[model samples]
Target chain A: MTVMSRNDLLLFLGFTVVVLAMPIWLHPFGAAYPDLLQRFMIYGIFAVGFNILFGLTGYLSFGHAAFFGVGSYAAVWSFKLLSLDAIPAMIFAIVISGLFALIIGYVSLRRSGIYFSILTLAFAQMSYNLAYSVLTPITNGETGLQLTLNDPRYLDRAMFEAAPGQPVPTLLGQSLGGFAGFYFCAGFLILAFFIAQRITSSPFGMMLKGIKSNQTRMNYTGFNTKPYTLAAFVISGMYAGLAGALLAVTDPLAGAERMQWTASGEVVLMTILGGAGTLVGPVIGAWLIKYFENIFSAINENILHRFFDFLPDGVDNVLVAISSKFVGEGWFLTLGLVFVLIVVFLPGGIMEGVRRIAHLFDRSRRSPTKPGKATPHPQPAE
Target chain B: MFEVIFLQFLNGLDKGAAYALIALGLTLVFGTLGVVNFAHGALFMLGAFCAVMFRQLLTLETVTLDPEKLSPWGAPLEIREPLVQAWFGDFGAVLVNYSVPASIIITIPIMLLVGIALERGIIKHFYKRPHAEQILVTFGLAIVAQEVIKSFFGPNPIPQPMPTDLRGAADIGAFLGMQANVITYPIWRLIYFLFSFVIIGGVFAFLQFTTFGMVVRAGMADRETVGLLGINIDRRFTIMFGLAAVVAGLAGVMYTPLLPPNYHIGMDFLVLSFVVVVVGGMGSLPGAVAAGFLLGILQSFASMTQVKALIPGIDQIIIYLVAVVILLVLPRGLFGRRGVMEA
Candidate 1:
């Protein structure tokens, strides 16, 4: 890893402060709760890892949630046997998911384009199906894996007399429930952001970018692209694993649903929705999505009526009736519509929209005093 | 043993027909438009909804309240009569009974308009974009389509019954001069299989005989050359997309009797059909149809108790498993052409 420059350090610092102060800033949006905040951090981590593979390499592995689910299952098993501490769980999750990715990636990397996507999707779906039936001894089938009484947590037993109340996850005897868990997840999110930042700048990252742009050209140039892609795949898989483990660490339950294609699609959407290939975009996208999922789903018919109360009775009823289709139970409709609009009009997603706005501001600042002057086109730094 | 095998084969045929129908349309679009349409499944679901809408329309009744006769806890005695029955009597009843088949009339035009509009509206712009963007936009469109269906239909599976005459099981054994009760199967499923064959045969014959299909096939072979020949290949491709949509819709319309459709049915079928398409080899019409049936029957056989005992949950993921092996072994797919989206 290369040394972080001043700009990189500043960006990291800003990200950290913003994440840490989310509880305060997010209060207005009514999403300051630890669960939703923890989700923002967890999915942010997932999307960041996803960005490293997708944004850099342009290998859209549709089966990433397999690793995420494996991570969660690994974490829960670690809690079942090793320790209730999140550190060991995270470690176990990352290592297991990394290996899982290595095998899947080795085979899947042989193919490219849609075939690669399908290959990954097939593997993940297989894993999910297996977890539900054949692997039920470990996965507990549809019931999912959860911490139960009489589990042998030898490490915790060695240190303490009995498990803590509520069987909450801990960090070296410090309780990690509630806001503490949020911070723990936030810490990993920041770390993930930093690592992603470092990788995005590294030479290896450039190789991945080259592979994304044109693998044939790189191949003709005599560079072995497989190992580079495989490495990125493993690293991103590890990130997904860590995110999954964190999900289990906070909730202490793992389900097969996490391995489903929809879960993988969610991460992909988060990455694209934020603007793939751009640092902080996936995180921002993940945050915005989580916020809307939490807040918009909570908007019931009563809330819509309240929102539309300012209009006349007839108009209010009509407006509320129409708007009601895109909120509450229909929140997914809003998400789909927004995502479609974003992909259609703004292919670069939220990041591109932000860039255009920023560019406009910059252009206005430069050409304010002049009329009909050609604005200098400079390459915008991603 | 023979009975079990034959029954599973029939089951597979039933499933394969549906899969082949869906995959056929998918491959058609992929071959013609060169776009990965994730919304193809949504088109299938919309076709199913057309059936639902047709039935609802047929059964729509007029209600009148009579002040002379009031019911208990009622303002007035209400009388309800089906408007179709009142208008056409016996024919109206027959129309109601055969709504599933009749829905094809509405589904064709609707799906065509949808496919053409979709091609012209969203997909036309995406032709120059990356495959990732194409997938994302279509995937987004799919989600929107399903959600809109959910909002309108309220996320519940709406069952469409097979026609009354086709409701009971047919004694296939008797037809084949075996035991009377042996090898019995539902009449509707058999009809569905035949319907799919007719549709598939029609498509192939159309392509084989028609001048239009020849030109379209030529365009599929080489779009640039066909364009240089002073032919409007793009418009034909757009029409091909509409034809694909009609195939998907008709499949959906017929499939309602087998599996009640909710908003999510399209997605469920979409994944399996993609597997079929890939296994059959992308852009190969015959391959899609063959793979759909092969996988479908294999899936049915895998669900047998003996098979399940040997390999638990194999039935649940047989298609994906087959897809993975095929993709790894034969990168171009089973019957995939040399360079049809192979890169």
Candidate 2:
């Protein structure tokens, strides 16, 4: 495979620089407020990792949250036992989560297709349930694992001395509730994005795509497909772990809800919505959905009544009733509709949509080309 | 210990009945149509709603009884001729004071129509799609179904009381003299258990004895071959889907008296039923039944205080835990037909 093009490299660098500068850029408009952008990026990182498995392998895992939750739990545990250095905590988190994924993947990957999906889902639910009860000491039961005053962080514990009777201690000098947590999460997301991008362009990624397209051909061609798939699965798990660690780092807690199967399904939705096979698609998808969730959920009837004041009272009431079904408790309805539309109309996702637009412009530019001569379109960089 | 074991065993059987019924419908659809009916749970909820509607028919209410010519009690009780008179007039009027059996007679046709409409309206469009897309759409449909039910049922469990004759508990332990309170199983649950057995038996017998059943079985095994032999496979498959829906609905209907029916009731059971179907080996009928009972028993055993003392929270995950172990050990499931899941 050829190296990435100079233009693409520039674009990647440009994107990374912008992401690094997001907090400052988003400050004025309060876009960075509520840590919303950071969440988009963190979930984007999680979705990108998830896409590597589902999008590449066509084996939809419905239990990725198990890894995510494991990562969070591991990181929280690290903070409780080891020093509060983010590096060590992150490393321990990813390693533990990857190890858990390795075992789960081994058993689950034995069955392919929907069976695999269900197995992962069941495992995730089992883990979530176990965490809520049997693993209460570690998971802290329904209350979840948080940084307590009792946690001995040796080196930087002084930074997090909560006032007496203030309950749980904050991480470093910041609660999971502020700008520092957002930046910390966004930084990891950028790194994860670059790694995911590299992996997709690598030979290993091609093998996974090959496995998706035709496992029989790969088998007959002398490749032991299990190790390749398992490797991909482990890498994906590590990414999930990193995302989870970042979530805990920002939020300073790990709850059983993090491991629920619905969380796993959300990742699948994010990956697909963004454009599964495309590197940037999952990020965009994650951002789009998270945006709707945080923004749309707040648009209540009072807001609607104020906005549509020009309409007659009766008509406005009807409109509000209709619109409410597409938002709020009915958010899934809108999400499901969008999912169906994308699946039916845009099978390749938003990236495909982008490519089509580019192709259209390219065609118009080549309208005056000489007969029997092909107007050049850029070759796909390896 | 014996008493505990016996009670747990009965508990397993109760839960097993629900699992087996849901699995049976799923298996029927999978076996015959080559489509996984993911909305089976919705159909089950619809059945419970049917039971609720049936029970509402016989409920007698006194509206302060026109007391113009009353004695010392001051009010004469008078029942309103329910609003059913404005709608079905004759049919609705007849149903106002009828017994549950009469109401059930009315419900079967309504449930059947609902089953057919659901299959033809939404599920038909998904038959040719990939399993993921099918799952998504059905998942979407299930959400819509549940939401619609919530709108109608007010987002709460609708209590459907059993007929007066079936209200008390049965004392099976008294016959054995183990203890006076050894087995005081609820009468409604027992009736539900018996009802499920009868329906299951009837279904099996119908499939086993009839020519139509033979053709459907043959079609299930090899649709192309059946089609080549001039059978209308699509029509039969559609019928089978409808039949599966009805079966699910009937199970839900009978199960309502045991537990109150709710909008989200279907989803609570869907995940477990899917596991049962998988553990039973995809499309295997007997496997679904056996796995359903096995998982049910394991779940009950896990929920026991003794088991909880050992594992802390075995009850919450016992079914899934058992499913994972079973899948790992027997990938094709306990009674999986060879080559069914060769891929």
Candidate 3:
């Protein structure tokens, strides 16, 4: 493992504080609710993991949701068989998802670009279909894999006597829910982010970037690019798995829908819409998308009426009617529009927009001091 | 057993026709424009909705007072009659009954316009971007298109019944000089298969016989060389994109009778069609067609009782399994060109 620099360490600590305090910060927005907050952290971790492979390596895996789903399944099984403690479940998830990613990445890495994407897609779909149908005994099919009261839970039994009511996943004996769940997810997200940051700044990260820039050139120079990409793929898969495990830890249900192509597409959208290859971009993208999904989908005509209540009656009605098409059931439309606009206008995504705004401010501040300096500085001093 | 096999084979052919049509269009776009269009399936769904919209248009109604019939709480009863029937009488009734087929005429023009608009408005800008970017933008477009349809038509599948004349089953056993009803299939399915063949054949013939198509084919092989030869290849490529969209749309329109038109129908077929395209070999027209049918038949066979019994969940993942194996062994698909999208 590479040691973090002072600046990197500070940045990691700052990120940790922000993530841990998200509930407090988001309380005003009314989005600090446990379920949504946990989701933000979990998906943030997923996007960060996805960025590891897609951002650095430029290999787009369209089937990452399989790993996520597999992780969830593994975690649920651990809960059912071993213990309600999230540690073992999460470890099982990471290991299983890593193994699955190794197998898939080994096969998919044979081809690059779109072919690789299609291959991963095929594999993911196969897993999804199997989970939905043939593996119904394990997955429990359409109803999903849920914790049954009769589950053996050997470790839980050995460690402590069973409590009354339905069993929930926990850290030691403290049940994971509400703020505790969010914090748990935040801890994992921070760990995942720190690992991702190290990977981005490491020598291995440079090699991956080289492969992304020109794999052919790297190959000609006697570098075995395969293992590097596969490593990235596996690492990212493990990240996705960890996120999935967290999901199961927070809420003990594992649905096959998580492995669907649409779910995979959602991650891709997050990575791109937040700016691929950027450290913070994917996490921000995940947060924005999850926020939109939770918030926009909940907005109704009634809410719209309240929002525009102070306007004239006819005007209010018309505004509410028009806005109604972009929220609630129309949230997907809004998402699609945002996706298209981002890809079309700002291919670098929100991170790029942020960078551009920062650039403008930097230039505005420096122009007053150095009026005659015509040459734009390519690299700004950190 | 023979009868079962024969029936499954027929079923496979019908399914294959759909896969082949969609994949064929996909191959055309990839070959000509060098862009992997994720929204091609959306075009297919839009085509199906066109049929739905046409049916709605033909069945537009008007109310009139019928003085002879009085409602319990009203002075006179209002009878609703189709505006088409009121205008064209018997011909209008016939038109309404055959709306699925009649929609074909309108669907072609509308789909063509849609194809042109999509190519011009969005895809034209993305021709130079990376495949990933193309995929993202087009996937976004697909979602938007699907959602728009959902908002308009709701999420339910709208059943578009076949014409009354084509409602019954066709006895393949009788046609094959065997006992009747042993090997039977729906009349509409046969029509769909035949229609796919005609359309596929027409597309092939158009490419092989026409001068414009020759230039497009040349462009596909070497874009720069074609451009250097003073031929306006971009315009031809745009037209090809529209043609491909029309092909996908027409496939969807005709498919309404087989599977009801739904907003998510395109997405359901999208992944399968992409699999078909890859298994057929990227940028290979014949490969796409062949793979489409082969996978379709293979899927049907996998779903057989004996097959499923032998390999519990084989039916669900047969296509993907085959794709994985073929991709591993062949890499370029069955007919994929060397170095095409190898980067």
Candidate 4:
């Protein structure tokens, strides 16, 4: 077995420290609250997994939310049937989501580009429609899949007695909620990040990137690219499923809305906005978007008024009126504008913006005689 | 059972008309510029709002004091009258009554302008980018457009009723020499279907017979070659985009009376229409129209009580299911050309 490199070890340790300290670092933004923090970690895992396919292989599966939703459903079902322990539920979620992804990925990988995207979208929408309507016996329809008091818990009945209040999912006997839930999600997120890092740096990752660049060229070279792309798709799908299961672990219910195209779009946006090919970029992007969703939407007219109170009366009123449109109910408008601006100006997303700033500072500090060598960054899939 | 099936078939035609119109515009943009316009549905929503705007404009009120009448609070009562009705009397009343149909006249020019402005302003910049970027930017634009409409009209569906003359159902059975009440269809829906045919036919005829459309078709086939012939193909492409937008707008304008227009109506139709476009074969006009109606009929049939009894919720996903099956069997779709968007 090859020994771990010093850089990889450092990166892993740094990632672990940063994620574990999220509650502290996020304190200033007021998004450090447990529920929101857990969401950030979960979605980060989702975006990172999504990057494995979209960033590396250039296959955009618009139906990943199906896997995510399926995972959630599976986790909830596991809890209903088994003990309240999250270990079984999480395993069930990942395995089921993987199976679903394998089937979907196998079929969808037949086409390339927009056709592939549309096919996945169609399948996901089918799943969502069925889950919402005819699959109500399992999914419980619009109200979502929730644990019932009389659920046949073959494992739980033998291990534990019924509690007075609704039971929450636990790790061993420790309930997965509050800070405990955040840490649990954070732990999985770290593991997911490590797995994604290994995939991105491996020979398989290079093969996927080759496919992204030119599949015809790869095929001409006698390389069967289909299995490589399919493998990437399934791996990413499992990542989505893991994230979905984590969502259920933190909160014990699953809604069909999780499988909607918009949710799928959200992960796509996260991956792109962070920087698709780069490892840390998606996690950053996920945190940024989730932070905005939580913080921006919470800013009502009163909050705006409070911020604008120091301004002159007329100026404050005008500013408040203008700023109000980009917050509260208008957060989506802001989100849309952000998406357009990011795609237009910073095609490489926030990471590119950071790189440019760093380059500027680096150039200013270094000798003027040396022209900075341009690094060849991989262009995002066409 | 026969009557039920026949009614659904008619219902399917009406639904098919909408799908056909939207997909037609989508194909036009894709075929010409090679850019996917996700905002096409928003243009349809905007067209619906044009009718709503016209109604609001015609019903603009003026307050006049009535000296003969007094309020219960002892203030002189003011009467509110629509300015158009006061000015043109019966003609104005008829205009207001038929505002939805009347809006088509205004909708065309406005939608054309909207289309041209969008192409010139935003879409033109994206022509050279990747399809993914095009999709992302356009998706963002669609959201913005929908939100703008939502801010103005709120999130609720705005019910636009048909003209009183067009409100009643037509007796199809009587016309067919069957029982009088055996099969009936709504008057507006029939009008809508015929209107869609005219629009579809008109678009095809324009493409087939007009010099401008001929140039555009040639350009679609070989853009660089056509450009070498000294034609201003770029400008023509812009105009084509506008034309496509107008087509979509007209579809929406007429559809207001059928399904009440909501801000998210564009999004609701966006996915379905894209499926229709893909099913018909991207960049194929006749394919889009044929697939639209075919899927529409299939969807309506799936919704049949007997069919639903056999397979519940099939109607909701029939289009998607068919799309998946078709794509798996035929990757380029039923009529899609090989090598087009394959990469």
The sequence of per-residue lDDT tens digits that candidate 2 reaches over residues A101-130 is 999999888888768878998988899989
- The best-first sequence of candidates by lDDT reads 3, 1, 4, 2
Q: In lDDT terms, which candidate is top?
A: 3
Cα TM-score per model? 0.97, 0.87, 0.97, 0.96
lDDT of 4 by residue, B1-343 (tens): 7788888999899889999999999999999999998899999999999998888899899999998899999889999999999999999999999999999999999999999999998899998998888988888888888888887888899899788889999999899988898799999999989999999999999999999989999999999999999999999999999999999999999999999999988888889999999999999999899989989899999998889999889998999999988887877777987767764
Candidate 3, residue A323: the lDDT equals 88
Q: State residue A100's C-alpha deviation in candidate 3, in Å.
A: 1.3
Output the lDDT of residue B263, model 3: 98
lDDT of 1 by residue, A1-382 (tens): 4688999899999999999999999999788999999999999999999999999999998999999999999999999898988889999999999999999999999999998888899999999999998899999999999998788889888887875455767898898888999999999999999888889888988999999999999999999999999999999999999999999999999999999999999999999999999998999999999999988998888989998889999999999999999999999999998999999999888999999999989877877565347456644667
TM-score for chain A in each prediction: 0.96, 0.88, 0.96, 0.95
Per-residue alpha-carbon lDDT of candidate 2 for residues B56-101, written as tens digits (9 for 90 to 100): 6545343456656565666675646555655666676556533344
- Note the Cα lDDT for every prediction shown: 0.92, 0.79, 0.93, 0.91
Give fnat of each prediction, in order. 0.81, 0.49, 0.87, 0.77
Q: What is the lDDT of residue B172 in candidate 4?
A: 97
Query: In model 2, where do residues sit more than 4 Å from their true spots?
Result: A1-3, A7-11, A17-32, A155-177, A357-382, B1-3, B50-118, B151-154, B174-181
- Candidate 1, residues B171-204, lDDT tens digits: the string is 9988998888989999999999999999999999
TM-score of chain B of each: 0.97, 0.88, 0.97, 0.97
TM-score of model 4 (CA atoms) = 0.96
Better of 2 and 4 by lDDT: 4
Candidate 1 structure, TM-score to reference: 0.97
Candidate closer to the true structure by lDDT (higher is better), 1 or 2: 1
Candidate 3 lDDT, A1-382, residue by residue in tens: 6678999999888888888888789889889899999999999999999999999999999999999999999999999999989999999999999999999999999989988999999999999999998899899999999998889999888977877789899998897889889888888899899889988999999999999999999999999999999999999999999999999999999999999999999999999999999999999999999998999999999999999999999999999988898899989999999999999999999999999999999988888787568446544556
Which of candidates 1 and 4 is the stronger one according to TM-score? Answer: 1
- Name the regions of candidate 1 deviating beyond 4 angstroms: A368-382, B65-78
